[model samples]
Target: MNIRLHAGTLLFAVASFLMPTVLHADVFSPTMSYSYADGVALSPDVSYQFNEGIGLSPVVSYQYYEWPGDGVLQLSSSPRVSYLFYSYLGPTPALPTAFSTTSLPPTNMVARPRVPSGTQFLVYTSGAFASGVPLDTNKMTIVLTHGWMSSSDAWPKDMANVLTSQGFGATANIVAWDWRVNANLSAGLEISAARTPSEGEALGGELLYLLGANYNKPIHFMGHSLGTMVNCRAADFIHGDAKNSPGKIPGSTLKLNPQNTHMTMFDEAGAVGVANALSLVTYMLFLPTSGDTGDLINNFWTKVIPDHSAWIDNYISEVGRLHHEAANVLLWRRFAVPVISDISSGLHAYSYDWYSNTVAAPLISAIGHRFSFERNTLSPLPPSGTYFLQSADLIDSPFVVTPLDAATANSLSSGRALVYPTLQAYNGLNVAGNAYLNGLNAAGNVYLDGIQHAGDFLYDVTEWVLSDFNGQSAYVGTGTAGSTPAYMIPAGSAPLQFFWDLPFTLQKSTASPLALNGANGPIIHPADAGPDITNNTAVYVWLPVIVPSNTVGMSFEFKIVGAGTNEYMTMGVSNENYFTMESKFLDDGVWMSSGVIEISKYAGKQTQLFFSMNGDSGLPDGKLSVRGIQFLTVAPPTLNISVNGNQAVLSWPVITTGWQLEQTDALSSSNQWTDVTNAPGVLDYENTVTNVLNSGARFYRLKK
Candidate 1:
C-alpha cells in the first residue's frame, strides 16, 4: 500500500531536515551519463580491487594517485557555509545548537572563513587541488560525508573503494569530506547533529570548488548517519548546477525547488504549476548505522531531497542501540519504503560492513538483491524502491535474500505485506486485475494500496513520529459503524514527537467547525472523490500538514496549468497522512474552502491537513495552493429549555471538557453571572439540569 512520490505527480519519499512532511513531489529522475577521459578508468587506485571488479578508464589500466590531505584549492573566495571552521569539529562557533533556516548563510556559497581546519576536502587526484587546478569535469563526481564520531577510514573510504571498484572508477571522481574535528565525539551525539547543516553546507561549497558552478557531469551523494543530512544541506546550498541542466538537479545548482508545501502528495493539492522538481543528486543514497536520528534529520531534509535528486534510496539497517535509522523518508509518502529490520539480520554493528559489501557487488547475492540498485521499476530511469532486504549478517557479500512472502506465507511482492490506503480507497479492496495490492495504481485501481511497513513507532532520538504521520489508529476516532471501513491494510499512525524541537510556524486556527461530519466527528478519513459526470482521471497527490488545535477549515486554490485534452483535476483535504480518512473535496471554483472539514471530534490529536489533486486525464502538472487554514473553538453546545409543569428543565449536548451552567440577569456588561447550584445528569449524549423558576428577569449562558 505504500507508494512514495517522485517527478510527475508525487514527490519522492524525501528527507526534510526540519520536520517530516507527508509530501510526495513529482520528479523527473533522469538516467546519468558520465564523462570519462584517458585509459585510466581502470582503477581509482588499487584500493577498490577487493570490493568491485569493474573499472573505468580509457587505457583499461589502474592508476594510483597520492591524494594528499590538508591542501588548499585555487578557488576564489572561501566556503560560505560557516563563518569559521575549527581544526576539528564541535558546536559551530556562531551557530545555534538548534536548527534555524534563517541562521544559514544565503549565498550559493557562504562567506568562507579566513582560516580553514582539518575538516577539509579530499579530491580524487594525484595531488590536491592547488591554485588553478579543477577536477576532471568530464568525469562523474561522487562525494561521501560520514556520520558523527566517524572519520574517512570507516565506511566513507569503504564506500569510496567499492564505488570505484564497481567498475565506475574511470569516469568517477570520488571525494571524501573528512570532518573528524566536528564529529569526533562519542558522547556528544546531540552536539554533532546540530553541526550537521553547517558542515553539510560547507561541503556544498567544497563541491563547487571541485566541480565548478556549471559542471554538467553526473553527481552522486552518499552519506551515512548524520552525514545524510549533511549531504542534503550541501545539495541545498548548491545552486547554478540545478538551474542549467534539466537532467541535473536544478534546485541544487540552478535553485532549490520553488516554495513547496513539502509534506503533501504528488502534484497540486489545489493545483500549482511545477516545471522541474528533482531531488539533490542523480542518486542520493542514505545509510544510517543505527538510531532514529537519521529519520528525523532525513525527515527535515525531505524538503531539499525531493527537489534536488532524480532518484533517491535509503538502505535502512535496524541496529537497535547502535546508531541511526534512515527509516521513513520514503515510507509515509504512501510509498512502500520498508524499514528493513537489521535485527532481521541477527547481527549488531555489522550493517555498515554488510551494506558496504552490497555496494561492491550489489546484484549478485541474496542480500545484494535487497541493496542492489538494479531493481525493477515500471519507469525506465534508475530504479527506486526502499531495499526490501531480510537476512542475517553478511560474510563476504550478500548472502541471504529472504523476501516478505517467506516470513508471512503470503504471495506478496518483495515488500507487499500489508496494503496501505487500502483496496477500499481504490474503490474496493479486491479489484479484478490487482495481484493483491501489488500495483494498486494501474488504470484498474488508480491509487496506491498499502505495502509492508514497520507500523508506527516513535523512534528518532529527537522524537519525530517515525513516519511523520500522526493519528492513533486507522479506525475513525468515533463509535459510528462504518459500512465499508477497509480495516485491513498496513496502517501509518500518530504524531507525538519524542524530543527534537518543534521548530515550525505553529498556530491554531480559531475558526468555527464545519458540519461535513459532525461539528465533533472524528476526522480520520480516506480522502477521494469523483465527479460522476466528467470522470477526471487525475492522480491526486496530497500534502500532510499538522492541523493545529481548533482548526476547523482551510482555504485553497487550484488551476489546471497544463494538461492533455479533456483532462480535469480536483483537490481534496484530509486528516490522515495517506488520505484514507473521511475528507473534503472541492470540485469547482478558482478559490474556495474544503467546506466539510471538522476537527473537534478528536481534540488533543495530531492529524494531517492534506491538499490532494485527483483527475482522470493525462498527468496534470498543475499548481495548487493551500492558505487561510483557520481553527475554531468548539461552539458552546446548544442550550435547550423545557418547562415540565412546576419545574424548569435546562439541557445541552454534553461537553468532554467540563463546562458550567450559569444564569445571569440580563445580557448587559453589568450583568452578574453565577453557576447553577444543581448538578446536571447525562442522558443520551446530553446533560440536563432542573431548577425552579425565579421571578427576576434571568438569562442563561454557558462557560468553561
Candidate 2:
C-alpha cells in the first residue's frame, strides 16, 4: 500500500533533521498597541487620530537623535502610527445566531463586526505630521511588511531603521505594517494563512488613504515570506478601490486599478496571492534563494487544499522554487560574510539581521560577490532595465545557481538557449580562452559579468533605477572599436608623387583628408580626417598603391607627431594577395626618414597601405597628426638564361635583398608551379644557378 505524506509530516521530518536554534518561542496574544511614551521615554511633538474607519488610535510623532551616543547625532523625524481592524478574510469557526438557525443552511459569508478587529498598521515616515511630511513626492515611498510569526517590529522595523540611517529616510517615507496578532504562528499555519488576506486588505486600506493624501508619490512595496502575499493582496485591493472610486484622486494617475506601484517579493509562501499581486503592480522583482524548502511546503499545500488549487498548481509549476529563495538571494547585499552553512528556517531568519545591519556602509571587498559600483556612480547612470548577473560559484556566492557544465556553457556561448531554465539563468561566466556567453538577448536585459549575488547587484541596480527615475541619460562605454567605427582616409585633391617622383592619381577613400600644406606635402590629422573625435576615439586611414612587378622592397619617410608632443602614428602595407605584412610605428615627435620595409612576398602584386591612429594611447590632446609621407620601391636584379648541352643555366645580378627562383612547365594561370631546387651562389653582385633539363619545356621567374 502507498501512503501519501502530508505537508505537516514532511515539515516534521525536516524540522527533526534541522534542529534549528530556538531564537524565540511562538507567542500568541491579544493585539495591543503602545505609544512612544509607553515604549520609550520620549515626548511626542504632535498626536492625532489616523485611519479613523479602522479604529486606528491616536498616533504620536517624534524626532529622535539618529546615533546612540554623542558622537555625531542628527535629529531625524518620521511619524509613527499604530492602528487595528477586524480581518474578514480569515476562516470563521461559527455563524452568528442572527444569521443562522437550526433549519437554515449555513453560509460562508458573515456580517461585519461592530468593533474593528485587531489588524494593525504602523507608519514610519520622515514627515512632520501623520499625513503630510517633508518628503520628495517625486522620490519613492517604501512600505515594508513582515511575514508569519513576526511583528512589523521585526524585519520591517529593521529595514526602516537601516534605510533611515542610509539617508533614504531623509527624502523617502518608509512605513512598516504590523499584523503580529493575526500572524501568531502558535494559532496554527492554516489559521494564520487564512488571516493574511484580511490583514493585507486592512493594510491596503491604509495605503489607499496614504495615496489619497500624497497622490503623486511613487510607492515601492517589499515583503518577506508570508508578508509577500500580504503585499500582493494589499496592492490588489488598493488598485481595485482606486479604480472603483467615483472621482479621480489628485496627484494620482489612478484609473480604476491602475498599476503604478513597484513590488518586490521575497521568499513568498503562496503563489496565488503573488500571481494576483503581480497583475496589480507595474514592476515586479522576484528573488528566490537556493536550497530553501518553503517551496516544497507550498507545493504540498496545492495538492491538499481544494480552494484555489488550480492557481496554486500553476504557481507551483511555474514559479515555485523562485518564490522560496527570493529573499535569500538579496541577503548578500546586507551581509559581509557569505552565508555558507545555514539551511531552511535558519537561512530565512538571517535575511532579517543582514538587512538591519546593512544600514552601515557595506564592506567593499573582492572576497565575495561584491561588484564595483564606483564606476556606475558617475554622472551618467546606466540605462534602466533588467540585467542578468551570474556568480562564479553558486554554492558559496549564490547570485545565480545554474550549474556551468560544458553543455550548459556551450548553450550559453552559442546563444542557442538560456543557460538556466529559471529566471536565475544568466550569461555563463567568461572563462579564460572561452567566448563570453549571455543568455537573455532582450535589449533591456544586460548581463553583468563577474557579479555574483542579488545584494550587490541590487545595490547597483538601486542606484541605476533611481538615476533612471530622476531622468538621467545612460552611460555605456567609450573608446572601444565597437562604439567607434573605423575612419577612412580620403583621396588627395592633387595627384600624389611617390619617392620615384612618378605621379599617380589618388583613389577615392574613407579617411578624412586635411588641406593644410606642410614643408614636404599636405599635413593631416587622423582625428580631423575621420568623423568628429571624442575623448577616446580611434581612427584609420587606407591608401591604395599599384607596385610594378619584380619590386623587391619599399621605403617610406613620415613624421609621427607634432613637435614636443607624445602623439603616435603607425603605417602598414598589404596587397590583395596577402594580409598586412609590414607595419611600423614611430614614437618620437621628430620626423623619421628612410624607413625600409620588405615587400619581397608581394613583389608582383598591387597593394593597399593602411594607417591607424589610436587616440586613447596616442596623445593627451587626442590628436594623431602626420606629415612628410614618401614611398619608394626597390627594383629586382636582371635575370639571364642560357642552355649548354643537357643543362639550363640562369644568372642574375645579386643584391643584399633575398629572392627566390621559381619555375613552371607553362606560363598559363592554371599551370603547375614549383620552386627551382638547384642552389645559387653569389659572387660579388652576380648570382648563378644551373639545373639539368631532364623534363619537358620549363619557364622561370625570380620572386622576392
The TM-score leader among the candidates is 1
**Per-residue lDDT of 1-704 in model 1, one digit per residue for the tens?**
23321111111122211211121112111221221122233233233331122234332222111111212101112222111111111111111112111121122111111122424677544323222335687776677666555677666666666666666556677777777765653213333443454566567666666667667655666665556656766665664222123224533443333221011111100111010000111011111111211221222322224344545444332111111111111111111121111111112123454556656656554433132222222133223332333332334323454433343322221221112121111211111110011011122121122211111101001111122222211112111221111111112222111112111110111122211223432222221221122222223322233333322222221222233323332322332221111111122223323222223333334333333233223223332323223232333356889889877889875422346889987888787899998988744335679988877766777775
Model 2, 1-704: lDDT tens digits are: 21111111011000000111111112111223322121233223333221212222334222111112212112222224311111111111111111101121111111111111323555576431132333345555677777666776566765676666667765666777776665653312333444555566566676666456446555666666567666766665565532222223555543223324555544444432211111101001111111212222221111111111001100110122232111112222221211111122233344444334323444332111121111112123211121222243434443232223444233223111101112111111101111011111222111222211100000010000000111121111111111111111111111111111111111112344432223423222222112322333233334344443433334333333332222333345542111111111123333333222334455445555544333334222322333322222233556789999999989875432466788988878688768888888643224678888976888888865
Instruction: Give each model a TM-score.
Output: 0.32, 0.30
Evaluate model 2: give its lDDT.
0.34
- Count of backbone clashes for each model? 124, 19
Q: Each model's C-alpha lDDT?
A: 0.33, 0.34
- State the displacement of the C-alpha of residue 645, model 1, in Å, after optimal TM-score superposition: 88
lDDT of 1: 0.33
